[model samples]
Target: MNAARTQTDRTTARSPRPRAVLAALAAAQFTVMLATSIVNVALPQIRDGVGLSDGATTWVVNAYGLAFGALLLAGGRVGDLLGRRRVLVAGLALFALASLAAGAATSPAALIAARALQGLGAAAIAPAALALVMESFPAGPARGRALGVWGAVSGAGGAGGVLLGGALTEAWGWPWIFHSVALATAGVLVAVVVCVPRPPGGRDEGPAGRFDLLGTTTVTLALTGLVWGLTTARGAGWTDPRVLGALGASVLLLLAFVVIERRRPDALIPPRLFRTGRVAAGNVLMALLGSVWIALFFFLPLYQQQVLGSGPLATGAGQLPFAAANMLGSSLAPLVARRIGARATVTGALLTEAAGLLWLSRMSADGSYLVDVLGPSVLVGLGLSVAFVQLTAFAVDGVPGKDTGLAGGLVNTTRQVGGAIGLAALTTLAGSVTAASAHEPLREALTAGYRSAFSASAAVLAAAALLALFLTRAGAPPAVPPAAPAPRPLTPEPSRAP
Candidate 1:
């Protein structure tokens, strides 16, 4: 019995702890998110240091997002084929190196290039990390809880990025932001290497098919064109020749991609995946929600700084309430979903967010943060966080194990693409409204523009809530179809002495 007990202790010591694995995965997720927003506060300093032109300065932010969004599908497919853990480690290493390069860059072009490389790494990390989470926890209460934790960390990362960016930019300097990310990411990478187990099967285990090169190229380029066009439209106007040309090329390329996907057996995004109503509806609603989510972060900071005369640090600090509420809501999502079901929970959350946006639309030119920002921010935070958790679950609910990475990528892609389009359109609308109100004081005109954007966002969320009612069934998620055979156990085969 003592020998047996000793044997058990050795076995346990050799195994990876589940909580440690989750923590490592969550840290990777947080690092990816932090890279996205951390640069916003440091842009001015970076611009000054790099001697960036106005156009180049914009690209500093856009470059990261564009690469991240465009390459997600390809990245996910690569993970599915190459092995998630292998891909994850590779991505983290690349991200860390890119961050280091970004921090040490002296030229505008070098910084932008490094940022894009960072995005490429993030595209690999996000989907692989999420897919690993789903794989780690089986479907049911455990999965739901894991997802809640995932959502909470994601929300916190965004807010933390801004706060950290402000503090670091003030205390250490702009480059520290990237250096800090590099340090944190390197730490996460080591934790992952230590804590996460290898894939159940060998690293090469995946669906038996060749990569769809043509389909991938077309879709990636199409997404790139679309995102670039939208981003260009912000400064160049929708009717500009360049914008029109890019949009036209994207539309054509997208059509070509659809045709190629239909013909190819090993398509990047299998058409069959969308046969389930939940997958389609979930992505749609997520897109809408993402529009508001990204827009809120962008415009809220601008309002605080421009209209309320708040400094960057104060603006970052003010988001604390929203961040706290977001984390709380994410934590509670599983419990709420268990009681009311995911569909109902999603609808309710959308309505709550809409209500908050509507309230925020009434902000005055001379309004204080207490009366105008805090209450609405709490509501929006709670609602957005809960909705995101539910929608994410919905998007991948019945997906096959073989395509889990693809589903993760798909959901992320929609959110990023929607955010780009929404931000551009709303920015344009706000500019137009502000121009129309030029007769008023500058502050009042700016407030009017912001109010209009908020009102429009509220309407969009309300529409999304109504759509959620129709798109999903009344009960629990539909059952998953028979998937490909599960991978072998993580234990390695015994080796014979030579």
Candidate 2:
């Protein structure tokens, strides 16, 4: 009770310019999300230009995702201890510097290293920005609207990454993609400095607490090992010694993390968080949802380019329909949530996703874009967009303000981990099908593999829908308005820089 009061005390002075704060937060989100997919279209050029073998090339993407997912929980904890705005600025600085390094890299090793640094920065920025948004807008109509815009930017940034990457790579070169990201991030950084107001203690004051070192180390390594093993399993085979060892070690480390968290005074993820049915169920469904969305982006490009013989630029442009639908859905999510409630909205969206994936599975070796792809892509995009917004609000709802950052980190980490695992599983399934169909024509074999993967993804979504129906709780707590202000101790003005 005292802790809750202390948290309420901390956020008493609401930022007067909520719109500016929302815009800055959304732009910050877009900047990090763009990095997630900007390099995807440029992967081929990166591999060739950096003299990387096919095997090593995957790391260019995997390294960033792995590091980002692994460190997210720790990053959120850090933000909770430090101020969210301060952590956000620090994260932006790191991300921009890493982008510079990535743009300048001439070797594969340097590129991969720089990508990992970018992931670390992203791990910090994503959760802090989210927490800041939640704090800035008092929960009610204002908060719902802010979250709607926030979700739209998150979805659009990811979908737009493909289009932007293609244009930049085709016009200039692969390095230019990173350079562009660096510039955009710098712009957002400046907006953040000017637009985001400091909290009552002038941003320097934070909740006095000890960092949970033991819990942090254990959870970070456990997630890293798990993500590494799953990502490598597609190429290495599940039975390979290295893959088996990593999986086994991850399991042991996770147990250790659980044990450590139970005993630690300042747990990285408090054990009681799981007791909240909403948080637990939200995280689980988010994982399944993440897997499907990530795999869709991954496999759809393959189908477009390899099967349809489209160029990279055309393939990226093809996703514009999905992006459009996603933005439309995001804009409508708050209304839907208000009408039917968050849980039902999410359940309905998941079912819609299943239906869309099932439609997509109807594709043949020679499929028409309009009938076979576009219609289903639009459905999937809209459904996933609504799901993303509702699920995000549901996950952190009812949690104390102090722990909202951790909740955000937890949900995002699960999503990333789920994506990695799902992609690997589906990739292996497709590889096996392709090998088995080796007797058929190459195009037919590839189509069969992709079709099977899409079917599997649809099944996953249906299962997730069922889980949402049964496990997810209905309605969130009413948003607590900020407390009235009292005179705060004098401190130095917040630094615009770290």
Model 2 worst lDDT run, 10 consecutive residues = 489-498
Tell how far residue 11 is off in model 2, in angstroms.
Answer: 14
Kindly state the number of residue pairs that clash in model 1.
0
What C-alpha RMSD separates each model from the true structure? Answer: 4.7, 5.3
- The C-alpha stretches of model 1 lying farther than 4 A from their native spots are 1-13, 200-205, 474-498
Taking the tens digit of each residue's C-alpha lDDT, what string does model 2 give over 391-483? 777667666777777887998898899999999999999999989999998878998898889999999999998888877654534222123
Clashing pairs in 1: none
Task: For residues 264-355, write the lDDT of model 1, one tens digit per residue.
Answer: 98899998677553778889999999888878887887788789988768878888898899899998888888877677899999999999
Candidate closest to the true structure, highest lDDT: 1
**What residue runs in model 2 are displaced by over 4 Å at the alpha carbon?**
1-16, 275-277, 474-498
